[model samples]
Target: MAACQTEKEEINFPKTDLSNMPMIPKPLKTIPTGSAFGLDAGTAIYTSTTDPAFEKVGRFLSENIKSKTGLELGVNSSSEAKLERLIYINQSDSVDLETPESYQLYIKKDSILLNAKTAAGAFRGIQTLQQLIPTKSNDTLTDHPLWVIPSGKITDAPKYGYRSSMLDVARHFFTVDEVKKYIDALAYYKFNTLHLHLSDDQGWRIEIKSWPKLTEVGGASEVGGGEGGFYTQEEYKDIVAYAADRHITVVPEIDMPGHTNSASLSYPFLHYAGAETPRVRTDMKVGYSSFDAQKDTVYSFLDDVIGEIAAISPGPYFHIGGDESHVTKKSDYILFVEKVEKIVQKHNKRMVGWDEIAQADIDSKSIVQLWNSADNALKAADNGSKLIVSPAKKAYLDMKYDSISEFGLHWAGYIPVDVGYNWDPETYVEGISKENILGIEAPLWSETISNGTELEYLAFPRIIGYAELGWSPSDHLDWEDYKVRLAAQVPYLEAMQINYYPSKLVDWNKE
Candidate 1:
């Protein structure tokens, strides 16, 4: 193991004066600004898109723009506006945008053009455009005169195809509204995937129609014994659709075999230690309980659970929680994993599991999400399976920044922002390069995040680093420069009313 890999890298807030303009997960390359285009009521969002979905995206963007600026920017296909203050969000024929998420934005004195090859790209560009639209005041639903974008050009695409953030909703059940807020925040940071940890030992979040008791009994209470809530099938669908509209694929995780206490509680015969009645766990210990790997009925239960979640989840991947199976025998663990893998495959979804699953007999195409060291990551990648590098020490948002920090765990090293952004996912391990890397993910295991403010406090600045690592190109990555850029976002974060922790390492005092 490399000495520096484990050693905590210190933060060096850049020496030079950096731009105060906020661009979280900054664009690849932006040129000098010219004249600015101020948005007004007459401005129209012009797009020749026939697809209702893309048109809906335009409407969504228009609505948000209108909300920020108090300008009713109508979505018009007929390009006949008098002033020509047009926001063109269209699929371009001129530029060869090879990636679905690639976009080019050109801001001129009169009009702004955002072009891409696909709706996904256009949506990403909208996120960038939103960042460019300054908040003139801290008041919500108030008009902002500075809802203007400086004249510049930005060609942006993610460095890794799958930039993800996982929210462990089961540990602390967040409402649908809360989840949407999280999705919007993730979209702002340009993250493309929201891996929803819908199931855990404490509770089951999504309504599984085939398994009614899973929610009726298992979802009734959360970790601290609050009346837990579960997203109904319709509500879950709404979340999937909402995420899709924002160009974020929702990867739902229904962890089984180990995080199966909730499941076992719902159906007592499902078997952890051969069938004793169980209750939803109120504690935080792992591997003390799991599904009966020996039972054929347990396999049937998996089929039902996996089938329901897979049916609702439109994304390609389904995450099976295959971590910390300390209680199950090694053979049983491997057996259970193999059975679950087949069930996922039967539903036409690719398998995703924690690094522990790499030890099981899984298909080469399955994705392994790593929260520990690189050993399992390297092992899985070597076998042709891709790895999402979310090492707990680096990417787990729940870990406290330093000893003085109030809200998170210290097990994963104190990850200040620089430590979060310093490591390159592609070069983290010896053998793992860009090819073996699927993307990078920052996971917030919600043991401590009980409310929206707490969640934001732990997630921001650090999660911003996750976005930068996944989006910004290798050459553009510099922690010193990034800390400055990150510090630049304080006003933006403040204006948005997001309760982010102002790091002691950076100067947040107004210049």
Candidate 2:
């Protein structure tokens, strides 16, 4: 194995300026305190509150420290940590906080205090804390010794409330462990949402007890005619719980009307009579199969499927993919979306669909994700529906890095690292301003990629840039300065064993 591939292998610690540590999604404010804190075996972590969530945050920090350095720090459930060197996690009762994910980190010579209004805030702050600890230590203890963190104060919060990363598990089924691994990477960058595209033409990736055949038959085949898999309710819940622990919400998507070949194949009644007998689609072609919008049985089937999925999904939104219905008549397509939106709401989940859903009379409370058309986005804004901006050219992670890229499609055009990082979400679309937006999401449609290595290659570096756009202030964005900080993130990526693309845009800190 290459030396850089192993986390324990010693590497040169870059001569970084402490004040400007390479932190992604740069904090809202950072001020150097001209001091440093030494974290050693004697250090203990104390929590101000008895809440289990707060305690979990404390454990998370200690566990990460133990993993990176051979130091097993103690965690104590106490209100105070006196004289002895310690790290404190506190939940504040302040009402002046910007958002639920906001937190303040104060590092002094003797102690470190992380304060936040909620446990989620504390969890987010812990990410910053992890970033502060250098990948390599100073002493000759195999480059892993007592860690020193530069003293500083950081007041941080995401500019947008709904930063998300969408994974298309339908085209390619990712195992629960694989999904958890992706969630870990998202948490490291402080992303709060993981949108799982659960169903598509190629496969149905989630189980519905009422519709057993949905998984038994529809889930049997994937994009390349491989034996696909599905996640049982228990496994699906496991993913949700794991994400929640990391302060990330999992949003489930079940595409309908157009991307329903799998569903139609499972139950022919769901397929339109005019189309050929529904068959397993191993190709990437879309907009060919659709649900019979006129049938009352279709709505009943959807209600049962939506209810089963919604009961397990604690998140507030459910995605009914409303894009690419070329064969369905315009009127039928609009009516189908209107009915499905009601079904989503019947289960207490706000409807979220692709930009095409804007053509329907969707509820003002629903959300429209901008993927292709600006007119559709503007129409959504006009209807008072908030938007999740994921313009294909800028935020699509599955787009090829260049013409020679081995994996991914380029219909949306190649999204080089710099092109992906340079666009501003707040001003990307003219009609949809910040008020109409609910943050941004980078959708990775798994057409050419299958395993974790290919998935990580397309997601990293670019997705890192998306995380920054979602969290940091819009006016403060700078590609030049940001690239330097991004370069410093190489160690963390390597340590995590992520097969990330080494973009030439940044001078990586590989010393």
Clash pairs (backbone) in predicted model 2: none
TM-score of each: 0.90, 0.94
User: In candidate 1, how many Å is residue 51 off?
Assistant: 3.4
lDDT of 2 by residue, 1-511 (tens): 2432342224333333456888898889988866566666657898865687898999998899999887777788353233246799998877756789999998875679998988999999999999998765656433335576888788888889999999999999889988999999999999999999999989999999999999999999999988999999999999999999999999999998889999999999999875546898999998888898999999999999999999999999999998887777788899999999999999999999999999999999999999999999999999999999999999999999998888899998999999999988767878678899998999999989898899999998899999999999987689998999989888889889998898887798886
In angstroms, how far off is 436's CA in candidate 1? 0.4
Question: What is candidate 1's lDDT per residue for 1-511, written digit by digit as tens?
Answer: 2432222122111221112345767787676465566565546787756655567768989888776767767786565434446788777765557688888888865578888878888888888888777666223222423344666788788888999999989988988888898888888788899999998888888888888998999898787778888999899999999898888999999886787788888888886774334676777767767788888998888888889888888999999988887778889999988888999999999999999998887899899988885888888987899999998878899999888887888887888877888888887788888999899999998887777888888998788889989998888888777777787776667667788888877776454
lDDT, candidate 1, equals 0.80
Q: Candidate 2, after superposition: displacement of residue 225 in Å? A: 1.3
User: Once superposed on the true structure, which residue ranges of model 1 sit more than 4 Å away at CA?
Assistant: 1-21, 77-81, 93-95, 137-148, 274-277, 509-511
In model 2, the worst 10-residue window by lDDT is 7-16
What are the RMSD figures for all models against the true structure? 9.3, 5.8
User: Model 1: which ten-residue window has the lowest total lDDT?
Assistant: 8-17
**CA deviation > 4 Å runs, candidate 2:** 1-18, 77-83, 140-144
